[model samples]
Target: MLDFAKGPILAIQEFFILAGQAVRNVFRRPHYGADIALQMDTIGFGSLPIVILTGFFSGAVMALQMSRALAQYGQVGRTGTVVSITLVRELGPVLTALMVAGRNASGMASEIGSMKVTEQIDAMRALGTDPIQKLVTPRMIATAVVLPLLTIIADFTGMFGGFIVAYYLLNLTPAQYWHTVWTALEWNDVSQGLLKPFVFSFAISLVGCYYGLQTTGGTQGVGRATTQAVVVASVLVFVLTFFITKIFVGNVVS
Candidate 1:
């Protein structure tokens, strides 16, 4: 019980400290543009297909369920509005973040953990190179930049999926579905959609980096850190989602 209590507090404290260092390194000297670009491709383009698939299926299923429910009330026309609003305001960001967390977080932990096990990180320090700047900063930067773009892509793809359902399954016209989607979207909703992923990106990257940097006990430890990174990052996506939505949308407690 005491270990459980203190473990989370210590992890939280370390995570924040690592996050602060990453933020500070963002504008510091010796910016790794090449590494950052490579990381962006790895994190962004590499994750696109999964993001697309997740968005498409989520929106499609949402349309199916919502349309059926609304049909019982003779309100099927509201399907587009509901699907679009929910996807843009919540599902798109959350789902995309979760997918990225599952994929990238584990990868980050494993890669850095391998380096740790092999003493590569020590070599960097010995050679006057800062390992955090070379490794953690680029990954964090790339994640921060890419996640919001992926969320935006997921948002539109989900809307497209909803369009397919609204047009065919629900017997709604293309124009009607699109118009509802467009009109129902407020600036705040868009801001929230984009901002949530940005914040989530930070959490995911920092958690991965923190665990990666903490790796010990050889190959088994890498495996443990990889699993821990994914679990913690995924949970943070949900936990942060609630707090972020409350902050932007307001009145969760009230």
Candidate 2:
């Protein structure tokens, strides 16, 4: 029997070592410019197109669904509010994080795995370079800092998407939709959603970098690590999303 129990145990062990190494790397290497570039690339540039597409589609669908559900109650006007609020508070960050997990996290893992397999990582150590500080730290900081910004962009774009669907496709008056949105949303929901992405960013970066560092064998092992990194990072993000939502609902936004 393939022991699924072993998976979580091994993953937990790897997480601690990776996290400690990442912290030490931050103090030792201090590659400010590289970190900035990585942040820009991972959080901004790579995430932009996917975020836009997902935001638009999700907003449109949410509006349509809410409108259908509310029609029976003569509350179709609530579509904008529901769509806008949901997008900003949940869908935006969750979807953006998923996309980033698939894109940047997997790619980063693959790159690092290749480096490790090629002995480049070993060479760095031989030449007195700190692997944790030079590589892992910059990536960890980049994703951690950039993910929330991406989520914000996604939130705005998603709201805009709702506006388009409600106003044009559904023939809702612009004032009516805007008014509905303003009344139904609270600041706390937005705040909670935005804060959650930082946690997701940390998970993605840590999982990707850790898996990469642990890569072994040859090209096949690197490939497996990349796949595992993306899969595990995405699952963790969703789990965190659910937990954060629970916390937000129970305490913060209640």
Top lDDT hit: 1
Prediction 1 TM-score vs. true: 0.96
Worst 10 residues of 2 by lDDT: 27-36
Q: For candidate 2, give the lDDT of residue 172.
A: 90
Clash count of each predicted structure = 0, 2
- How do the predictions measure up, each by TM-score? 0.96, 0.92
Segments in model 1 whose C-alpha atoms lie over 4 Å from true places: 1-4, 251-254
After TM-score superposition, the amount by which residue 69's alpha carbon in candidate 1 deviates from its true location, in angstroms, is 1.6
Q: Which pairs of residues collide in model 1?
A: none
**Model 2 per-residue lDDT tens digits across residues 4-29:** 78887877887897798776666664
lDDT of 2: 0.84
